[model samples]
Target: MRYEATRSRVEDYFDRTATKTWERLTSDAPVSKIRETVRQGRDQMRERLLARLPSDLTGRRILDAGCGTGMVTEIMAARGAEVVAVDISPQLVEIARSRLTPGLAARVTFHAGDMLSADLGRFDHVLAMDSLIYYHAHDIRNALSVLGERTQENIVFTVAPRTPLLMMMWNAGKLFPRADRSPTMIPHAPKSLSRELEDIGTLADLGRVSKGFYISQALEFRV
Candidate 1:
């Protein structure tokens, strides 16, 4: 599959929204009555993710996969954790670099390359925030294998949620309607994901997670 094509489409789509969209993503919920209405859903999701973080993340070396626009990277950096952030979009890399303060940039290294290609070194936590969803069930399996080669501590997986095909298609059009705009090919089946992890390089197991924004799952691995 032409993964680069899909990356190009998503980068362009967000570039067009860089000014407004990125800020909306990075900031706290607005205070005004009307403005607060917009923050309800995603704000809740972010809180859920925050609550789910491993309790011992402080001072840990972390990998922020698909650290688009660096929102999550900056968060981890603020927590005083050493973070290496990566993304496939050069445009987002540029934006993230420009947006980061020098002090924050010092602790967090932002790279524009495929996580599948980059040797980002070992990290206590490997975070794939809304990332692996772009690839197929097998491609995600392959990515997990690559992660296994790198990190031995734990792997953090955050997806756009797994849902029925009809709902997934509706979401593709509603949330990400760019070039191909449809995530029809990305597998959301639980057994497929479990099987991919089996007999592979990493020891992956099903784990507990609070679901929203398409039922995010974390497959913690010890390699």
Candidate 2:
């Protein structure tokens, strides 16, 4: 099943993020204009999320799991946090490295690794914005384990979910009786959170927030 966002292999999906997603997302006439449009408009809605986070990020060690083009990384840096930005794509890392604001760039360290298997050391905070949705079940579980291992105080992440995929799938089955099987348009109900992301932190509901143009739920856990 392929997601239209980057149209990459589920195995090599992270690698695709290294390409022209930056310029492509920032431009007006980009091919994936619909997705890019929502992301550009994401700034306004990010306020509620920021309010739910620590008051000051000054001197805090942060990990941006899938830093992409450093969009949110800029905000963390502006707040005086030392950021370690990692992405699966070298191209995206290169762009982020070049686009850095000298001061922020100096504070940021970049790495390219698969979140599913990377061994990032613990930090004051760990973040994986809208990136984790690419992972299915086991991958999500593994990511939580890694996050728990690396966070000293908190872990904040977002997932774009609507009801649950099972219900959505049932509805689609009724609507399109003869349609062929295809990729999922959404994710499933999390059977467990407290159990899965346990031991290392205290979990809090960051509540619902917007992503790109879509509504999503943000979850935070303190280590």
Candidate 3:
């Protein structure tokens, strides 16, 4: 249950900060501003992830794993995709459901649970977003393997960068234990992540987004 503790911590953190987290991801403002910069970085990362998906999602089945507030889930559902949105935080899941239009709501199913163990069936595409940041390397591999099993086509996700500068900052942030309540930032290298996905029969396409204290690498794994 090593991951269980991290999962519980993440769930509690998101539950406590769900509204602020949603604004930080969905807001639009000048990037020169510190808060806006972080928001824009997350928005950019999401845009880059969506870019790898099919332009027309009509009838496609997608699993929005760790779908905090349903941002991606709503977008995909609006495009006519049937989406299964799962999150560890019940609070976030409730918020996500509330944000959906009635029509969009019908197209999406919301589940509160760990993506790695969710019995949700297969999908044409699986999106993990920034969810994997809670996991260490071995747990990440396990999660990716589970995602691979459930995905028929692609899996797109984001992870903190493993570079020395970023790692130093990540470690420094840990010195302030309050930040520890936030998701455990287990930074990941693209090369290492790619090898992990390869073992699951997927090839990775990697991209980076940096803003404020957030620097993440987005990986799109094609099956």
What TM-score do all the candidates reach, one by one? Answer: 0.72, 0.72, 0.89
Best by lDDT: 3
lDDT string, candidate 3, 1-223, tens digits: 8788888888888877655656445634233466676776777888889888898999899999889888899899998899999998887888788878887877999999978764788889988889988688788777777777778888888888888887787788777767544565888888887776676666565678887756789987765
Candidate order, TM-score descending = 3, 2, 1
- How well does candidate 3 score on lDDT at residue 73? 91
| Whole-model Cα lDDT of every candidate shown, in order | 0.63, 0.62, 0.80
Specify the highest-TM-score model's number: 3
Q: Tell me the lDDT of model 3 at 100.
A: 85
RMSD each, Å = 4.4, 5.4, 2.5
Displacement of the residue 177 alpha carbon in candidate 1, Å: 10
C-alpha displacement of 16 in model 3, angstroms? 2.6
lDDT of 1: 0.63
lDDT of 2 by residue, 1-223 (tens): 3222322432244345326645456334455656754665454335545565576888788888778777767778888888889877777777778777887777788887654344556688777776665455445556676676766766777665555544465468546533343223345343355455566445566666544345565677665
Off by over 4 Å in 2: 1-14, 26-33, 116-119, 164-186, 190-202, 210-213
Clashing pairs in 2: 153-223
